[model samples]
Target: MTTGRAAQARRAADALRQRIVAGEFANGRLPDEQALGRSLDTSRNVVREALNLLRDENLVTRRRGIGTLVTAHTYRHGLDRLAGLAEELTPYGTVSNEVREARVVPHAPPAITRRLDIPERSEAVYIERLRWLDGGPLSLDSTWLAPDIGHPLLHRDLAGRDLFALIEEVTGAALGSAEVTVHAVTAEPDTARVLDVAYGAALFAIDRLTRLPDGRPVDVESLRVRADRFALRAVLPRS
Candidate 1:
């Protein structure tokens, strides 16, 4: 059941959310409800409802006489480069990993094995980690590595290090490139629980396969990212 007011509020909230994330409000404060309503071509009640929605998302705060305030910080992830999460995010805030699962499996799933170019029933190393930015959960990464490259990482420190850097160290070869795909998905029960999001909350899934300079596949990873905490950016020139 959807009402006109609710729909309008959501629309208003989306617009404001983008502006806040873009740093349009340089002072981190928003105009009064009436002014915002006029700019957004809506009524004061609708604008108030929109601001409340932002408040629920922890993106804004409202006070009696102070009006609405933007309070969320979104990290920009450039899609044009091949870099690790920590490597890209450290400039903004501290990044850490919680290794939830790290073990050598007798055989990985068929699809993963195919992507890694291993035999159908070949063994592989599996790593599942929860990535934290500052003090909050940012993403959940599940990576499957070919044995030759992964065995060396079993004893290495995975908590405070980036897998990309470690992989280069173990192989003595720099990573050449990656095949990456990004898409939106709803959080499943397990993912929602791990990321502390409500069931069916919107999330960004990044699937990537990394190759060495010689073009041999070494890693296949899928990262489930918190949509509100991250944004993907890239510069594309028309050909």
Candidate 2:
């Protein structure tokens, strides 16, 4: 069935994305199409589709002579600077992601509207994902932004893609500053399952409302990170 084949292609893409995020291809190139097909348990046609999706998202690029080359999509985390969740973990190890949700919201919620400063009736794009480092669960992020910014994002494969960069690129509204809040919380059932941790486990929650340089709100993000899996450090110099 056509639907079945579509599902297979999506699965293939997800698996490949996970591997890419996991740093399995440290040489920075994917296996040949046939080899990928065999390893991913899909046909060459399916493998081609998966690769195409990754290319569309700018995760990898094809060359005339060489195979797909992984793009430079990483940023370093700074203690005294503002950055995205992915950037915050660069000092740790290799980072990857699993996208759980990506779609459009017809009616933006009040809390979302308040943060992004969009109209109540306007739609938005919602992206929920779980990030990984060296094959272990790391953090879960739920992000929402204006529809104009989210529309183009709805089509691409997101695994292994940097959410912060994609948001700024499509929206043309880079994050100049953010209102951040930190909290200690216990994991809920859904959160536990996604992060592969026990329910009621202690976690660190980072909430941020980001704004563009011109004072326009860009996005609101909630990141629930596993306590033992990540560390946050900073330095201070007295005047």
Candidate 3:
């Protein structure tokens, strides 16, 4: 496809993806390509390409005469706002955590140290968890927290609470802000086994640095989220 047509297809796919997430498609079926093309003000070929894109993402399936079928996941996590996994997924279903590892590390790696803005030799608390939504694994999170804020969590219920809430409760300070960077990464062998996806499957990798209201960095987290089970959303303003 030409660059212009490719762009149009992407735009069309994005629109349809949002509609699918919003439950706009009745009975999980989309309108015919010609009808979609008319509604989206694009060509039938463009709509076909758009549907193909969604199919590649495993969000839809095209049948010979039955039309397009929506199989997209129901949860849309907002990228514009900072919230815990449990908090964001609350509207959909119960979010639970299986704490894999939680302990105080005497020395964190250089990369983690830099993200938390701590000395290379500084002690940090490390917590690894597999987050589940309604009994299915959704994300695998590896978090490193500055000693001060994370020490109290050593004995707390890590599996039953949101990490952000735990941090605030432990420190008695509200979380101020967070810097998040999200990108796609292929699942490695260990990660794939943990999340139950095929090796080399695409996954969403989010690296976040969260801070206290006073600007002191407290937490740095790396999360691998299942692409097939979640969608990222954001509203941008043109100013």
Number of the top-ranking candidate, with lDDT as the measure:
1
Candidate 1, residue 218: how far the Cα is off, in Å? 1.1
Number of the top-ranking candidate, with TM-score as the measure: 1
Using lDDT as the yardstick, the better of models 2 and 3 is 3
Give the TM-score of each candidate.
Answer: 0.86, 0.64, 0.85
Model 2 per-residue lDDT tens digits across residues 100-218: 88988899898898778888767888999888877778789998977777788777657876777887777676668888888899889989888887788778798888777887777
Off by over 4 Å in 2: 1-79, 237-239
State the local distance difference test value for candidate 1. 0.91
Per-residue lDDT tens digits for candidate 1, residues 1-239, read 65699999999999988888776897878998888999999999999999999888767888887878776577888988999988999998889999999999997899989999999989999999999998999999999999999999998999989999999999987899999999999899999999988888778999999999888999999999988778888888899
Task: Return whichever of 2 and 3 wins on TM-score.
Answer: 3
- The total of clashing pairs for model 2 equals 0
Ranking by lDDT: 1, 3, 2
- Regions of model 3 farther than 4 Å from truth: 1-11, 41-46, 63-67, 236-239
On the 0 to 100 scale, the lDDT of residue 71 in model 3 is: 65
RMSD vs true structure, all candidates = 3.2, 16.8, 2.8
Q: What is the lDDT of residue 133 in candidate 3?
A: 89
When summed lDDT is taken over every stretch of 10 residues in candidate 1, the lowest stretch is 65-74
* Decreasing TM-score order of the candidates: 1, 3, 2
C-alpha lDDT values of all predictions: 0.91, 0.77, 0.90
